[model samples]
Target: SQKIEQNSEALNIQEGKTATLTCNYTNYSPAYLQWYRQDPGRGPVFLLLIRENEKEKRKERLKVTFDTTLKQSLFHITASQPADSATYLCALDMGSGYSTLTFGKGTMLLVSP
Candidate 1:
């Protein structure tokens, strides 16, 4: 069986600080991993995708590091702001194409003034 878990609590922090979130998994061999940002009542928007062979990936303000050996991934948002507050989701690509994604519920991020 495969399982993924993210922090269920909302991370509250002041603006202009880096926010770090964790994703943990067990017993899954995923072909690819993705991170997405989702606002309330909206669909998730893809942020970064890292393959099994790759170690780390980055986009403008976001950085993601994947460690297959540890069965974990770390997501970082630098200089987070109130506007950056949202839920972040981590998904595993199962590679079958039919039911390809298994997503962790998400971790809510709250950046305060």
Candidate 2:
């Protein structure tokens, strides 16, 4: 009964701007949350991971915030560029130290010059 969804459309934007993405879910009790960046026809690269007890996590220009009460997560990319254009994914931990990641369809980001 758990579900995760992300924007299916490509986000078109100019270079040097911040891009925001969303991940929404329901009926999942996750011990931790993870975000990944994927390029066309390739495996997703792990971005950030936040535990249930944590409020926020960051890596360089990327920031992620998790809200368990709302069952949602937010991903942010500051000073995004054309090279940053890629699909971002979110995963929820299913527990047992062996967690299963259910990825969203992903949202493509397009950064123009």
TM-score of 2: 0.93
lDDT of 2: 0.86
lDDT of 2 by residue, 43-103 (tens): 8999999888888888999999888899888898999889999888888887767777777
The lowest-lDDT stretch of 10 consecutive residues in candidate 2 is 94-103
Task: Report lDDT (CA) for all predictions.
Answer: 0.90, 0.86
- Residues 1-113, model 1: lDDT tens digits: 67999987889989999999999899976778889999988999989988888889889889999999999899999999899999999999967866478899899999999
Would you estimate the TM-scores of all the predictions? 0.93, 0.93
Q: Candidate 1: which stretches are off by over 4 Å? A: 97-99
In model 2, the Cα lDDT at residue 2 comes to 72
Model 1 CA lDDT for position 101 = 85
